[model samples]
Target chain A: MTVPSRILVVDDDADIRTLLGEYLRRHGFQAEGACDGASMRERLHRAEFDLVVLDLTLPLEDGLDVCRDLRTRSDVPVIMLTARGAPIDRSVGLEIGADDYVAKPFEPRELLARIRAVLRRTTGKASAVRPEATRHIRFAAWTFDPTARHIVNAAGVIVALSGSEFRLLRAFLEHPRQVLSRDRLLALTSGSDVDAFDRSIDLQVSRLRQKLRDDAKAPLLIKTIRSEGYMLACHVTEPA
Target chain B: MTVRVFVILVLGILFAIAGTLHATAIFHGPPFRPTLQLSVLGICTLSLAFITARMVTRPLRGLAGAATRLGRDIDAAPLPVTGPTEVKDASMAFNAMQRRIRANVSERTGMLAAITHDLQTPVTRLRLRVEKVEDDDLRARLIGDLASMSDMIRDGLEWARSIDVAEPFGRLDLDALLDSVCSDAQDAGHDVVLREESAAIVLGSVSALRRCFTNVIDNAVAYGGRADVSCVVDGARAIVRVRDSGPGLSDHQLGSVFDPFYRVEASRSRATGGTGLGLTITRNIVVRHGGTVSLRNRAEGGLEVTLDLPLAGAE
Candidate 1:
């Protein structure tokens, strides 16, 4: 009764456009292809898409320009296809409101996984996963300041979190006491593209656990729920 | 008028007036007053010349000093454009020339960055395609080759970044920085020891300078078995030496070792993997901080990498 989530792929390469479109369709998702900014605009005007897989390099109009324009006009979630690996370019994409990015010549499956993750985060459903309008999250002796995107330990020293690591930890903090299945975490961390089995989630969880130092003293922080999934076994509280 | 000509003309006029007054005094008054008048004229001319010479040379000396500095340091502070209009114009032109040179250099660096960026798409594509190969051994080999290729390209790009150094400078502790780097190397199974006892404050882009020291210690431990790092302060500069016990480079290799990707592996072991740009980028970062990086072979069969950075107070 309900149409599947629609994704728009905007790329200049025709082979990539067709191949990627077919790949997404075979995976049971609807996809539309656009060559440049004008066609992308027409597609958006015709119907709303769940997410946009935008390439930073285009024929006529620059991808970043289109992304910046898209941010001002619509609330559509965008995942940038960047060829440059420079951190400055990545920061610029994030600054212009791109939800995520995948370097070009990327595996089509990787792109699909990212699209799904971005959609899950952008669609209204994600608000329930990430508490809305909260500034601070506290668990154990660590304080999570989402605005600064930094974690401070008991000594009040900041701990560095790689991008995926932060996303995984934040997901756990948000879904405290609830066992999060690998598939759910895969969607949460967007680390499921090449990971066929449970490689990504298991690796990310163990990494997060290590950073959290979840041991006998902090035993209940993150617990392996046997064959079920992973659970942040502690209470997640917000500063009043 | 030129300062010299003006001084001469003023002196001439004053002497003419003084001669006329003395003549009038001698002709109209006592003969005994002539000596006093001559002495007065002598003192006036001598004092006037001394003051005028100093006034003319002071600002000119400043301009000359600034010109030589501008020749050596492209980013030297502009000559104060606040003197006479002619001097102001000259200083302003010099400042403009510095700005133009800086802009030109940055533009070239940007072009290099853009070209290096072109390598990424194909590299990423190859990596993905390699992952799909059915042969396990072949796939693993191709992936490893691709990764090294990627690292090499990244080193080229990092070299460009070091040249630009867009990050703002910050004051950092030399001791803590070395401690962290040594700890990281040790964690990675490299035998690196840091003398954390010595403390020096330096102004630099923390990440850039950290990358420099990391590269040095990495090269040391990779070629040599262990790395011993020590920091010392000497006058206006802080010196850090990373010494390793590995086989040192020969006389010929030492000369070109810091050349991008220049490797001494021809005579030494081939186990180490590097894009060759490590030393190149390290040197660029150190030079940007008004520092120097030098490599020398230790008599005990190893290499010593020494870096000298200007202290914050010195800067």
Candidate 2:
């Protein structure tokens, strides 16, 4: 029998910590709660946790400080929860080595999905730390800033992206020159629990293509494979 | 300023009286020439008084103009303190008052933002706790209520933040912004279409402008069923129009639609789900960018929202 993954949730709010702990436990994970940074440290010293869900607004020491300190000491995945959904805060969170970020007032299911995704990405690796922080990714005369979650064209025009389109594009940029099937694309962008409607992937791809200004009839950027899936027909370079 | 004007008026009246007395005494010796000399002296004194009065009231008129400008924009430049002593002192006081008002407004906005931000924690906690309810329908209803509460809190924060002018202005492609906004709305399954595009560029705060456009489009989709948006550059102004196909609003309703918390009772029911501050925030953002937004009922049974923004190089 497989042992459930252990998770530690750090939040100042007692009710939230307790409720989230219970929810995670109900979903078949060993969950623990910490009131603040000191307790969180003590818990980490006492037991091994697969992931840490850290709240950005703590009593004294914030989640950013805690995550930075944790990064120096350990490679466990940390997902930041912030009440402020500002773009600057998100970029700063990711820059400080957070695995993912979830704004407050988020759905519990969404949080669960994020936690699972982060765990899967970490456990699949030999060393649990994320490969260096994502920087500006360049592909096909376009500059994509993963931290800002937007793209700038060769003419310096910023093209705003929808959530699904961003995720799909990021997925493609991460693995270029490979045929990513519709099911894989769906699972990568919208979690595995979503109902796999094949047409949604095609529609999302077409929309992303339109945003990229890639000709749909004879697409030069993203190519469709017959009886398989789609592939990014371009080289992606990441600059620090 | 008032004291200086009063003194000028008194001095002018005294001079006019002295002139009259001197003219009467000198002309008393003559017969026909006496009447002519008296009348000329009277006209010259009247003209001199008129010139002095205008000079004295010029500072007062300037103060009034400055006050009117301050009323329209809280961050207007301070009144230039170049006048008589009393006028200078009055302008100094007016500038101080303007500073105090600006501080008070910023403080109020900060307080509202802090309060609204703090509400997120409890709302998130409540939402998570709601998940524990075993009954599906009860849990769903509870979640819905929580969602609307959070929505109101979010809107409240947005309204408070709409007055902020901290964002730096930059050249933005209007065509690209509208295209992205419309595409985003369409992606979310809303009935939004970008019928026309303009290559005009405007200097604006990017995120704030995006929010402004998004609020208008969202309102149209909510009340008017679908939004057909277009943009055109006419001379130095870029005009954007968003039209919808639903039943048009009444004349009275159209007038009050942009007012904060004003809703059309017949069509904009609670089920439509808005705090009614969408248009108010939009108008605030538009006015901040030196633009105007207006709503009018279309002849073909719909509502059209027009936004006019000055082109980047026009000013």
Candidate 3:
């Protein structure tokens, strides 16, 4: 009795667009495709989509540029499509606000799973509002607010997080001072980066730590527990 | 006389002797007859001097031809060292220049390829997250777009990496190579049949040739429904032809097929998921092996891709 999540596909390939559109529809989602960045912007302006699947290479403007521009406007979750064996450029893509990336020649099922996971996390509070009237959570001299989708440092400067990173940090904030393993973090974040064998969580954590100005050797907020995983050492306080 | 002066003196003596013999019958061997003989011999000696001068300049002409060929074909055989010492030294220098150019090109290609390969991982991660969208439509579209873009990147990167001379050259059985390519196509659910495979051996980089055949056969199957591979000896050259049953290319598109990023169909839609660099790489490989690759629109409503390699042991 609810509307299906909307997805925007940005690629220049017609067959891929048609096949993916039909395939996603069969699985119960509303999917539309744009051939390039200009068309993607037009579609974004026309409708409110749940997520964007962006390809890095395009005709007029590239997917990286699109991701950068979208980051300035919306907090919509972005998954990048990258070439097989292209590792160096991947870091630049991640730095530009993309939530995750997948290699080419991927299985359709894997793609479907990723889509479902991202939607579940980004739309976690759909329909049902958190009846708790408070909008912010305070943890160890830091303030995290899902409504604002940002974290305020001790100096009160808002540090921006990408859609999935925000979700990940929120998950950490939700259970402060507890060790959260990779699987738990993956489950909480629910994006394409949470593959069975992927080490993206560690990388994301490192990135998050860098932004938070937390020392890796002696992390104050999030500490690594050797082989066990990660623990948020900060105490969380939700505003009444 | 010493050797050099002896040769010149001998030439003068022979001319003088011939003059004396001609004068003996003309008059009784005195001043009038001797003077006439010397003048006649002088003309003959002058002609011989002119001929020797031209012979000495022949090496310079050969050097010029070699220089011209070197400019046209960077990989042409080294210039001959049979000329004078200075000319030989120049030839050696030219060969060294070619080696440096080849080395530079190879190094650049290697760096580009390495950089591209290193870029794949994070892009893949970003792609996976996009796939996790709850909206089924958005998720699928995003994946499709990403896949195509990835293909483009791969092709672009591969093309950039193709300038290297890493492909090892060796003797390959032309028939066996064609058979393997056909089998690969069959494995990929393509209808590729060898019309007449020659058992003739080719001295080439086996891996490069295999890749070339793979690209051509793949195109044949992807665009054309079937492939017909065959090999024949034309004169002293071994020619291999791959015919496809797909809609043949236009006359104009034939020449452009081997150019990088040149798709016959301008749009390059998903139906034909080509990055337009396959044929370019194929040509580069073939040429690296001292072979030539060409494409022609077959009159029988299909396209024919042909490769001409110099026959092994053929003069």
Candidate 4:
């Protein structure tokens, strides 16, 4: 008899708020809607919410402002819904203690996956609060800008990673020198929503190894453990 | 004003010639040493003509340089109105024209940004609402249509952004960039191959150049089924050829392919899913980097897009 997670959807458009509310509810969450920041604050005051899906473009007081204010008072997870191609807003949202972001015009399934991933990460207490400051993750001659979602090599060349590749790399960077099982890797990278298999994880790992220029037969950076899983054999550092 | 300057220049030269002749007649004896006098007159006329020509052309040269600067940067400073009356008038007119063009460009960009920004909310709403459709087939088709619509909207915004030259230029490895783009395309299951690459370093806006190549490759993949890309540095220019295996375009279509909204196969574009602005944006980015992009039907049966970019420190 476990209670479902409570979610709050904050958007100016009534139709959007209602639709997202219904969608979240149908996905087994107790969802509530707020038309703007003022009502969002009132909802928070009245009830407890595990997550807040805040839209960046809201009337009068915007989502960023609301999220910033909420961060000062509470540690509740905030997921920003930003416009596509608004990279600045996305980075700023993440910098302001928001947990994750889903670009607008996104697939509903994608949003659901993001919501689930954020909830899982938060509840698991893997580094309780997301680092408030934006930092670049450096590992073995590669620099990863989590905000920009790209990797730069020692030669100062930027390499763009596909979404899954980025998530996989981030997971490895976050936990270096530890063998990550296929199931754990899949959960971290694709969330639980995707019907991915162990082979897909292997394929993704091989592709990533190719990008890193690591030989598959005798890999140097990412080593495959016998009967265990993959482990990043390099030291990872987060440089400001 | 120019005519007046010309008249004065002519009069000054005539006076100098007459003075030189008078001096030669008075100073020299009977025959006047015609050879020396003629040489002296020729030297005087030549010196006067050279000085007058320089004086007149200096103002024109300044105006020409300013015009060239304006062509490269719309926000270039106005020409200094400190020359002869005609030159001043011409510069003033040029400055006014520059101002008008800047205003118009900003206005159009602002409007496009506003429209794109406003469209996102409703599109998102529609996407969410459409998910509730009971019929699975109808829902999938509706989602497909919405996805394409969103793609067009996103492309429109990108096209508008391509006009902005605010991106910082950096030295980029052409081979590495091509490798990444091709690899990414391959990862996406697009039939793209980087057949050849050279260690070519180019000075360009990294994102803009990336977008340019991506659009070209995407276009090739969408229409041509596959893209065979090759890059080589020839002397001072890095030449990249993206060859596609699609049916080659007609001569008329080739001429208009880069034109905005001009799709070679209009009906095919709907199926392939592009706003027909890919090549247009590609050209915009290439030209901004002082590069030239051209498309031609391959002799063997396909279309080849050639991009010639100046290597870093070469130009």
Candidate 5:
């Protein structure tokens, strides 16, 4: 029989740790809890955990340090939990190689869904319904794995991407070389439920542009279509 | 300096000699025609001598030493009461004012602590009770609504009792603070990035400035998906820009964004709850630091929140 996926939940809050452990166990996964970085290190020594659910506000060592440290040693997918209400922290966490993130006071079901999604993406068992699964897009000497939610540069260095950036890039990759209007991009990425006046997508693009090192003066990968929105002026090859 | 003093003394002596001459002429030599003028001149000479003596002996003797003592210890020896009645009274008043300020600050801090502590139990109890509600949607909605109240209570108490809300002047690294803020947000799963990452230092209350930035950034991320932070240092003032790609506020709604409990979007229901105090608290903190916060919808689409603060150590 295949071993149940061992998930490590690291959080300072005892209640949250217990709650997540109970919830994850109910979802057909083996779960263990660690209150801080010290305990987390000991737990890691004991056995290999498939995935780690880490909180940013740990006691001794901060969550970001743990993330930076963990990424260096292993490819174990980590989903960070942050209480800070800042969007930059989220992007930074991803940039540091956190596989996924969920803000605090998050619904248990959403957390579960994210866990499952991360696991499926890592294990190459993602649903066929993900349209980008069949497409492989290359831009600016970077390879974007939409199914895996991973971006690797030419030297095979994993580039960190926020959730919004991932989604936006995926949209761009799917319709490569085609102009995607802001309204259309919003509809495709954030769904119609998004606020009408939200220019968040534009900011996300700006952030993504920074990561890609795309110059505003002369862009190569993602170019402004003007009057339209942005277009991914790149080559895409579908998975065989 | 010595020449000026000598010249002042010489002028005094000259005036005194002139007064003696005029007085002698008035009393014995010849009947003085301008008796009133001569008497006025004599009085003026006497007054000048008295003023010069006071300026040289009183303030000049003790002013530097008094300042040095005050700098060394806030509770140092009181200013000497030997100068003049007016100066002595002023010194006494300064000591009394210092004592009063200390007492008032301590009293307020204690009151804030008491209030904050008093509030936590109720909020905790409410949170515990909220967990027991079985209806998923109603429970979530109730909790969401309650969160705002709790946040408001927390912020209100913190604001009311903050010791450094009116902080003493000090220099701060504005650039480092912004960078740290951005880093903190980046750690929180936000898509916020510092567009212009340059180090600039300014003089202000560190905590108050932090609170100000936190409020503006929180509003941007909670309402908008991402925030673009930029700071432009212009001489003695640093203009901080926090631009968000959220739903841009209407021109009419822009004015009221900083009003407490005034939310521009009606759809800020349980899912995304804000106390509507973010902007208000932000503006308050900034203004307290002798800074200003302005919100305007960018012509290119998005809302830009600008914070103008006096640069630290700038003249």
Candidate 6:
């Protein structure tokens, strides 16, 4: 038997609270609702939740304050709902420890995906998969650091990787020397973007190879196993 | 300013005539030497008057140029309050009015934010409720229609907030930014290629520029079958051209493409979830960065959108 995840939906709108609760329940999760920060605190006292869907604007107490309080008190995953596509609100939401953000008029499916991703991130040690805490991954005389969002080459020059490149490289390091299929790489690296197996992975790999100084004509590091998938043809280790 | 130029020219002519008469009378009727000296004096005075008039018109031209520059980017450095007191006062007043205009626009954006903020809750509620529609096709259609409506309203809010750029300017690598955007578009299954990379440095709002390029590139991929993006450092401007191999816009329809909510056809973008606000927001952000964006139908086949953004030292 498997235990269903408990989700708390916090919004001033009663209709949203009810709809989210019903929707999550229909999807085989234990769901509950709270109108504002006070009722949310009461619910927290009575039970534990696996995640929180928090709205940024609220009555009496703002959602940021509630999130701050939740961060100090517990480790519940928080997904912020922002009003517009304002970059500032997204930054502030992340800076204040919200795990992820979704803009208004969002597809429920999108939010559901974010919730699952956040849950996977938070439910450590309980699952078979490992967490992404490794700071520096070394491979083929190069230092790939996820925290710094850069990679250091053999000549000790730091090269910045784009967001997608960093995610794709990290996916490679997680399973080195294994011929991972395009589908697997897409699943591992997919976020809001790159939701499918596309030529983007091939292009990203080529660009990453160029940065790593891997020979594109006869690649030594990331090799393409034709008719199969791609493999990081190198020994990867964590550098202290 | 033209009126001032006309007044200065009239004054210069009057001064020239008056000086000629004065020189003639001062020398009286001396035959050779006096006449030669008076001619020299008269010519010198007229030239002096003409040069002074030119000097007066110079700052006026500066003011006009400053106005045009300020129109493009509100954050551009204000007109230096030099020159005559009247000019100084005008420059100072213009700067103050620019600040007021900026504040007023931002205030309007703030209000739009408030109203849109209230709207999201209901929209979210309605979307969630639509999941219980029972009929598979009905549920999907309701969800899709609701999602489009939400996107449209969100675009409305984003359109209002477009003028409000709260991001700070930073030293951005142009090549890297373009590469990232094209890569993202390519990842989303678009045929986007970064053909050329001419790296340049620019002081601009990173987020705003990113959104600007993404919007343009997205339009290319959506409308054009494929997108070929390139960057070049042409003097002080970083020129970015995004060309797509799709059916280009007709000449008559091109002028209205950037208008808010203006769609070439009702069904074209609606199916793709485009709110028709992408170009509007892109234009607002590019103009905020002292850039000009233009679109033209390429004779070879598709649409080509070019953006020329001023570099840090260009202006």
Docking quality (DockQ) for each candidate: 0.12, 0.32, 0.03, 0.39, 0.03, 0.35
- What TM value does chain B of candidate 4 have? 0.86
- Which digits, one per residue and each the tens of the lDDT, describe model 3 over residues B1-315? 156456667777888787667867577644455565667787768866975565556767876787776654566777666555776787788778878876777677677666666555444545646755899998778878777766766766656645544443455556656765665466456788887746566776554576688889989888888899999878777899999888888767886888877887843767777878999988777776667888877888788889998766674
Which stretches of model 6 miss by more than 4 angstroms? Answer: A125-163, A169-188, A192-195, A198-240, B1-32, B36-40, B47-51, B75-114, B266-269, B311-315
Name the fnat for model 2: 0.39
What is the Å distance of residue A132 in model 6 from its true position? 8.5
Off by over 4 Å in 3: A1-240, B1-111, B128-131, B156-161
Candidates 1 and 2: which is better by lDDT?
Answer: 2
Per-residue lDDT over B128-185 for candidate 6, one digit per residue giving the tens place of the 0 to 100 score? 8788888999988888788777777776676776776556665666776777677667
Model 4: per-residue Cα lDDT over A1-240, one tens digit each: 078999999988899999988998888999999988889899999999898999988879878899999888777788899887665787788877787888877778888888888786566554444532246778899987777546778987666565567678877876689999988887777653344333388988997897787899999999999889999999887775
Candidate 4 segments exceeding 4 Å error:
A1-3, A45-48, A73-75, A120-123, A126-133, A191-203, A206-220, B1-34, B58-84, B266-270
> Candidate 5 lDDT, tens digit per residue, B79-193?
6665667666766776686567667756775675466545544453455456668899999888776677667666655455333335544555566567556655774667888
Best by TM-score: 4
Per-residue CA lDDT of candidate 2, range B21-124, in tens? 66676778544455655676676578667766776578789889989887667788988887768888998999999999999988987887788788899899
- Model 4: lDDT equals 0.81
Q: After superposition, how far is residue B193 of candidate 4 from its true place, in Å?
A: 1.8
Chain A TM-scores of each predicted structure, in the order given, are 0.65, 0.82, 0.60, 0.83, 0.57, 0.64
Range of the 10 consecutive residues with the lowest summed lDDT in candidate 4 chain B: B264-273
lDDT tens digits, residue span B1-315, model 4: 687568667767776776777777888757666676667667667877776677667888988998887776777788878776887898899889999998998889778877887788889999999979999999989998999878877877777777754676767778767776776677677889887658788887666788899999988888889999999999999999999998978989988888877776643545786778899889878878888999999889889999999998898
Docking class of 3: incorrect
Ranking by TM-score: 4, 2, 6, 1, 3, 5
- lDDT (CA) per prediction: 0.74, 0.81, 0.71, 0.81, 0.69, 0.76
Q: Higher-DockQ candidate among 1 and 4?
A: 4
DockQ class, candidate 2: acceptable
Better of 2 and 5 by DockQ: 2
Worst 10 residues of 3 chain B by lDDT: B161-170
Q: Worst 10-residue stretch by lDDT in candidate 2 chain A?
A: A190-199
Task: Give lDDT: candidate 4, residue A151.
Answer: 75
